[model samples]
Target: MKKISIIILLFSCFVYGQNKQLLYNFTDIPQSLLSNPGAEVNYKWHVGIPLLSHIHANAGASGTSVYDLFADNGIDFNEKLRRVVYSMNKNDFFTVNQQLEIFSGGFAIGPSYEKNKYLSFGLYQEMDLHLYFPKDYAVLAYEGNRDNIGRVFDLSDLNAKGELISVLHVGLTTKLNKKWTYGFRGKIYSSLLNFKSTNNKGSFVTQEGTNNFYYHTFDLDLAFQTSGFASLVDLENEGQNDWNGKAIKELRKRVLFGGNLGLGLDVGFTYHPKEQWTVTGSIQDLGFIHHTKDVETYTLKGEYTFEGVNPLFPNNGSGQTADEYWQEIEDTFDDLFELDTITKNYTSWRSPKLNGSVSYKYGKKVLKECNCTAEDGDYLNEVGLQIYAIGRPRRPQTAVTAFYYRRLFSFLSGKVTYTADTFSKTNIGLGISSHIGNVNFYIMADNLLEYQNLAKANYASVQLGFNYIFPATKK
Candidate 1:
């Protein structure tokens, strides 16, 4: 039943990792500044379309797809379930990441405007959930220990994390000389809720004993921490009449300055070492969050050995009764886990991200001379190799992408990317940015090959946004 439950979870829920191959260096959209603070901007002033500026979400399972289970075949459903379980390993994981831009705008500033200097600001809300497959736990729960005596099941397999937070940020960008341009962004993070249980250590082992068919031993050192959740639960307890209004009020407070807050920084730059070649690099989320309010940490540490347990009642009924026997079993579990809860403050680091790319451009697309604007990237074609990495709880996730860019018209441009990562090497993505007068709109998506049958795709993601821009005017 546990295995079935896991399969169901895989079928209904999943998340795409935070690798936006199509949008990473697509600088036409102002959102590119979020990824690379130093990204070049041609607009003198810009404003996002309120909450519609950017909306992004990606969903899929890493190890299996829904079609794998529901496909009509001659095989029995139980057999299909068994195959799915056996195919997964501890390395398989599920994750969900989403973001919404609330309000954003930027404009040219001061005397630096003549030198291409600009200031930008924005606020956004984000959510992330990551969980790894508990392979050993599933096996032990489904098959029991009698079949695999002496095999140790690792407790470390139970690793997962979830968080919901909002960020308000401001950045400064400027072009220095002809070869280098750089920028930095300062962010304030307001955490609404967070939960993580990772870095576990322990083992569960079963072996033959003198008194029974098998003996079991549990050694555990595990912790689970959370914030902003206790207050929500207390609010729900108030009753259904005012729960909606109160919850909304509470969420608004948390998303703003009322919740646990932290600070972070992002820095990046572009370098033109040659006329035709370019290099760029950036680092994001270099910060940590201190969970001091509405915080709770649960820990389980201790060791226990169990020889066996018998539930058979004596014929005379003179020994232990049913209630006492069950109570004894419950006491045994409590002793082994030694569960304890404490309201303690803790600090958690953000999953810092790294991005770097080398690109070459050619094929000039001559444009009509303009009085106010200098030509930037006159070339119509570009090719590049980009590397990406993001820190995770257990290890750093990485990916490599090869991309090509083309300018189809004065107002239309497109990019195509081929990426190789932990999910799959055949991942292909496309992004298009269009300029109709002063409105800038762009959309990007990954896993294009699976569009025909999205249900069978292991990874998929898309991002779209609209913004208004005022063209630069030379002073």
Candidate 2:
């Protein structure tokens, strides 16, 4: 029972962390193109260094951390688990998101050197999960209803979604003028696995009754769903004996475009109101997938009421056996709450995200000896604020970050950020980009201060990539 409770809590604690706040609008790195396709880049062409091009991972939890569960203090494990569960709220959550790039590259596509149009394309794999804390369900599971006589357990606390998909994308960016640049990206999503359950209703309650000392009532409407994983598990007997080497090989084949398919779009623009002020915005993942293969759905919808059972032998012969009495009760309960499992095709929409930022450049002008088209060029220092939001099952999660950027030398640039969000209020991040001749590299990390003791940290992320760039020839 404790093992089951732990699994439920782990699944219920998920939250999304794909904001990539530090990398937004950092134009030196080509991976920034994924966040905002309209980002301005002065290079003529660029190519990612194969598999090492871009790698990212982010994880966060609202009410608890890894230290609470694994710390080597002299305390009972069950007691610590109870304390953590009780400290969390129904709205608190945990989330994880990760991406790996296979290959990416971009180049100029116009006839004239003066033309400012560019094309970019790439392929990557991603996995993401979001789950709200199931506080009511946890209480009911851990401590049975023997002590609480009138309290009710809510069923709506069950809400979670997760997905694994591979994406193929192409984009085009064109400068309308010296002050404005616009871009659009087309995406094809191949979903490998997906699961979601939300919008549940009903509850369970116990009270004193006229016919008996206690009466219990259960009114539940619950559903669980899955796609691309039904064939790997033995649902009939709730077993995994068939999940062997052959099963894994078949699953691997579906990771490509061999599963469900969908389409999405991302549109963005960068505007320079003046020479010193810049603004940018973008919307991403506006799409849906149709699950027409390997689908499984389970549903339970019914209401049942039970009073104390009557005594079989009232001070007469032998009393009813405990096993027989409990067996009868179980049969009656099963009949009341009819369970159904079926295979049905369905469609699900991707969680759309919105990003916007504004920045002002100041300080001394930087000189570019290689490509000198103007007397004054990029600035040595800048400051900016960024806003991000993503759609969720209950509401949209939002975050705000303020950052300062600096160019220490001709080949080194970096940015520092402070952010406030649902997971934590003290998220600090750093990003650095370096160029040695034609080769460019960048690395970014969020919540850096918490790395000192990872057990107490609520959120952490890191991203790194490499690219080869070519400068435009002097006319």
Candidate 3:
């Protein structure tokens, strides 16, 4: 559940990251990415069930800023194993951060309910488990006093099991007026995010290896919004819950408060000279939020220096035994260099975007166009073409502009009937939508690239949803 929730969150971010292609194409529909469920409205509710599968890999490099630190201080020196010792003296030792490339894949599938142009509500159960992860390492080696040509090691080769997490979400939205809308939602999540390495002691021998431990944690969420969608603040995982089942010598308890808030404005106007052509534009996700907070924890690594020993072994000559030497070494090391607990905290600030679109429709696909011959229902079909542009803040060169065309087939199934939009890039998708007697159903798929490309984080995704539209029939 937690895994699926995470995937949904990632998908939302990737799609609506900054009003690019999928959800918010600056099409006049107010969209919310933080909550899985949407709000209610007057138009047909767009219910979506989306399933996403992909593999994400780190493609950057680990630099030298960290290597220089390990060399300057023998404290974190990689004595025998060519790896630096961490957690020995937390506050003093330099912290190293690096990037890597690895094969990691997972999938998420669930139902989503949403009402378009009126109000929207949503709920979904999802899970995206990771079968593999990148191999990262921090090496510390010194040669001939000055010229230290460190040897690169692949730490990812160590054996580790896959992890599965899950999440559930529910949301609601309502329109206060023509220009103002409001929404709220709550989420519950749990992560079985635990794993162990295959090397056993060989991997756990040093700080670099010992750092491969896993833990399970759960989080919470609280959010609300007002029309015009000026800004929103999300509060998540404020603290840990009570756990009395585990039998540990020491059960320490800690509390934390964290999440992100956005502050911005969305202003757009549609221009339709012939009523058949509509153009819209808006700047989206213009503000930044902290995705994660810096964390500080203990990462200890060190060795024992023997003292009392036999004559052949040296230290205490033939008079002392191994126990005496071991005890002496332990006492000396403990007194000379004490252990330190580290606490780290950092924040991730994402980029914003600017988007716009021009769409042209050939017919009226509304309630007035009941051209269906069926005596029981109304169906409207129309053809549409749209040219859209999307740009990111940091990397403008990667900006993408696409042209889309959608063909509405029929509404005989009790709702809107439309096929997925096909872009000029030759990417094809399917769309199934319907709204009958206040019940709405919608499904849309994007990208649809090959399965192998999906793992590369370079493919398309599919979304299907169902929503019940309850208009304020009475006062």
Candidate 4:
């Protein structure tokens, strides 16, 4: 009974390629190369499950979990929300990313698999959204500036990024000798829509005034940029009532090669100094996109101060009335916030990620005298620690995972992980791969402890795929 329970616990699968600690260097799955281009795999050729080849979704909040505000602890809901907001700082953030493969395949080259090169190619669509916690903005909206006198709200706190894109990629890996293997992947990216608003500077403040009233000050500079959404704006301007099919048409035009495009490169290597020890490292998405079509940038700059609104009754005909006074105030604000719009080409760099791990193998699997299976030369168990980092606007996001991998049979294998990162202190993950005949099916998941009751989870992710692997045939 205890052994069965352990099996069930280690079988809930998940992947975080964005930091995919489970999938990195996990050589059994061909798609593992997405996380580490230089990954090691034993297949001579393979075909993916078309659209079902790979499916991944991840979302996490660093500030707090959902249960913190929605718990059934008999506390006031609003009070709970307030506590959550207060407990968090501006550096905290929420992020989400999802990917789906359209198609993928790979094949080995040369005389023999062990002494040659392998090539893999595929296409996938992905979307990502990232945002930092705006504590000052929340306070301003919740209590208004009236309650917090002389407080400054920094406009720079508003940092965010979002994008939807499709990537076409091809990779090649070669073994130079028994001790070294290297690989690299080339990618072309097509973006359907994207937006960024990370660079900003200014402050909003409410202070006691000299005119026997409160003074609201706005010394502001802000900018927002977007690409590939010009058609929607035109639809609204044209007053078109029917937007169903037309919207889809616009999307189709951009999702293909007609959209904003970019290039990326991924490279890595695997090394073994001793028979039982291995080390691997890789960098992914070192590239940028050019946004030239349907591009727009909006900027708000300059300064303005308001003591208060005034009611005016002019005795002279040249002066504004109470309503005109309001109009005059409106005009002042209009000039103060005169917006500048531009349509110019800009380059946006893809956020690059880093992965590295060191592992040692032991407990050789009991095998037949003559080696005939793929698992023959492999060990029964492995233990290792991996590190992951990704570049961000404000800083780099990082995590460390320690894992244990076991191969109970030639057809079934699994890995269990314990991770610590900005998202949570205690995150447990599991991944399983099964090979029956030439077909392979894999699934991985993490944070199962919190998954028991999702509201308590600050992070959640899952990855799964199917493929057909063929044995290497020597020339």
Candidate 5:
């Protein structure tokens, strides 16, 4: 049942135009939502796996992994498709790149130092892996199921096991930095994404349907984030002397590089004059990632017919004999296979991000003296009201907007809350931390709100972790 469910899910994504629609609204929304407008955040990191879901339709349901694959592949195909002035340019259509498969994972440890009046730093290490599947095999899997009539047919066998690629992030912390602190990370990311797929011309007769689905070997991708831009800028400029008072056009083109480059940065800071509140912000994921692959295309055709008597496979029952059923199906479809267009384009791309947080802290602890002394018993309780913007610059006519708040009960416990686009999406979080003989234990529950989005079936998270703070000492 689970397998069937998953398969159904995959099919729905393929046929339902499952694509991540870009968010283009700015209004009262949650801080979390605003922080990463079009980009997916690592918020689900603590949940064990990356959150591939979308927050678009109240349900937050994201397109399947194949949707992502196809979109990216489509981007490549579209580019190549644009250059072909002739539809019969099969040479431009069929091209293949070598398949490369790579995988790796590891761990690390270290300490870092931050030089800021209110910042401290610590060091750490991590491990990660990268994977790539060649286009030939990928397209072959896509066209593996074909019917008669030269319609290369079946859609069910295109499923490919997604590589379990992982990456470790370990680095310095800008703790104590009252404002403006910086940190660095050393990341090692590697993987094998090599794949091959092929489709042979063939015709099949069946009771499934009349129009045969043709299979084509070609590269498909949604975007060139890592490839397009690189190819564009790498061009070298060369020009010949002008003739007849006309300037010569400069000849230039991008050079393809073998290895990919990864970039990252982490900077955060805070300001708190009084003992109660502070303002903080930072930027993350400021870099680019690359993926390479070989592509292939194929052609196919199939036919489907309907007959009355057969009850085993109902839907307009196919005839008793498989051949008879196929014969009837052939009546619906004629020639299924024919020469078509095949094309490939090369390009690269990139994505950038920014985020910030702020809040007003008010409470007894904040309003009282430094600490409870012999003269002063206890202080008043404290509460915090926070609001911040992330993602693109805040606009008035946007669809979604957000801000987050946290009411702190001293330093041991507190509540985290957020509101997005008014009552559209709201989240409440609670956390507590206590020290048992110098050992500190903490737990937090996020997304307390009941949100209905296309991207999410049901989204909630609970995390348990501990951090130890060494006591300040005198030398």
Candidate 6:
């Protein structure tokens, strides 16, 4: 159990905001297409530089931080653990997400005279995880019910979901007159692995009994389902041996549409209410996958009452062997409470995300003075507010951010943002994009204030990428 907790903590460190609000409208980089297909593109063509194209990792925890557990201040480790567990609520959760662009490129497909139509395509891999705090179960397992005799442990506290998938997508963006631009993307998802164990019900209670000093009752209905994982574990020697590299090889082969497949769609639109004001919205990953291969499920459902086991001596036998007595007790316990493991196919859905923003440019006249075309509404300075939401098992999580963008020079631009979300309210982020003769470089980070004392931070994220772009010919 301690090992499991450590693993969870380590994973949580890799988690927060998938929104990337600061980079949303930054049209200098081609990777912004993934977030909003309708985002304006000023370049004629762009290509991501191999593996260094786009790499993003974000993680967040709502309840505690690494400093809460590992900070050495002469306090007992067990006492610290107890304090951390008790301080957390049942709804607290840890989330982690990562995305890497394997290969990507885009180009204008229409005639040279007509620059309104463009096509973009890419293949990327992503992993997402969400684990809720199991407060009742943790207390019951860690401290036991001996201290609190009447406390009841609720099974609903166990809720978690995780998935790893690769996405191949193609998108088309076109201008629909002078005020509106729309885009659509079609995605093919190849699921590498998945796990889900929500929707549980029941409880465990210990109280005074009529005949025995204490009585225990357990009514549990639980099911844990997983796919593409069991076959990777070698149980020949009771799971003591490592996998023989066959599963990883198979997974690698399936990265290109060979695994469990699914379809998704992204739709977005940009509306220009006025010359200086614009509104943009997008919805992504509206799809599901059917897991039909290498699936495993475990279920436990029963109601049992224990009033202390009573030993019986048989008259026919001179003396009951220790193994026989223990075997009899185990068999009786199995009869009272049963657990079943089965293999069956299942279906899972991708978490749908929504993003919307409104921005107003203020220094457009300055661009004209600097000999900038400003045809695509590129402004020298702008401020905007962005809202983001994603659907989860329990509820939808939401975040909001206010950002300021500045085009410092012809080749350099930057953005600053302040965000409020489930993790923290004082999240300040910065993003910078630079073009050195058509070679584009961009990087962004969140929670800048916590970098000095990272252990006290509940959330942190950074994204960096490089791309090669060809400028549009001067008219």
Per lDDT, the best of the predicted structures is 1
Segments in model 5 whose C-alpha atoms lie over 4 Å from true places: 1-5, 8-165, 168-170, 173-261, 273-277, 292-353, 366-411, 421-424, 449-458, 471-475
Q: Give lDDT per model, in order.
A: 0.83, 0.82, 0.29, 0.81, 0.29, 0.82
Candidate 2 stretches with Cα past 4 Å from truth are 1-3, 6-16, 234-248, 310-329, 336-339, 366-374, 473-475
What C-alpha lDDT does candidate 3 achieve relative to the native structure?
0.29
Write down the TM-score for model 6.
Answer: 0.90
Report the lDDT tens digits of candidate 2 across residue range 193-240: 888787678889888888888889988888877788877564343245
TM-score of model 4 (CA atoms): 0.88
Candidate 1 colliding pairs = 15-95
RMSD to the hidden true structure, all candidates: 4.0, 4.2, 16.9, 7.3, 19.1, 3.7
In terms of lDDT, model 6 sits at 0.82
28-66 in candidate 4: lDDT tens per residue? 888988887777776789989998989988756787777
Model 6 segments more than 4 A misplaced: 235-244, 310-329, 335-339, 365-377, 473-475
**lDDT of each residue in 49-141, candidate 1, tens digit only:** 999898888866667776566567778867776776678888787778899999999987757537477789999998888778788887887
Full-model lDDT, candidate 2: 0.82
Better of 1 and 5 by TM-score: 1
Winner on lDDT between 2 and 5 is 2
Across 1-475, the per-residue lDDT of candidate 6 in tens digits comes to: 8898787657545555466776787778888788888886767889999888999987568878777876788999778778888999988888878899999999887766878877899999998888888889888888898986888889989998888899999999887767888899999998888888887888899999888888888888888888878766632433322344566676777688877888999988888899888899988899887887778887878777777644346554547655676677677678645667789888888888898999998875345476865665556898999999988888888889999999888889999999998888998999999999999999999889887877778888889999999967755
Q: Against the hidden reference, what TM-scores do the models get?
A: 0.90, 0.89, 0.37, 0.88, 0.39, 0.90
Show pairs that collide, candidate 6.
15-58, 15-59, 16-58, 16-59
Candidate 2, residue 215: the lDDT equals: 83
Scored by lDDT, model 5 comes in at: 0.29
Clashing pairs in 4: 13-444, 13-445, 14-444, 14-445, 16-20, 17-20
Worst 10 residues of 1 by lDDT: 368-377
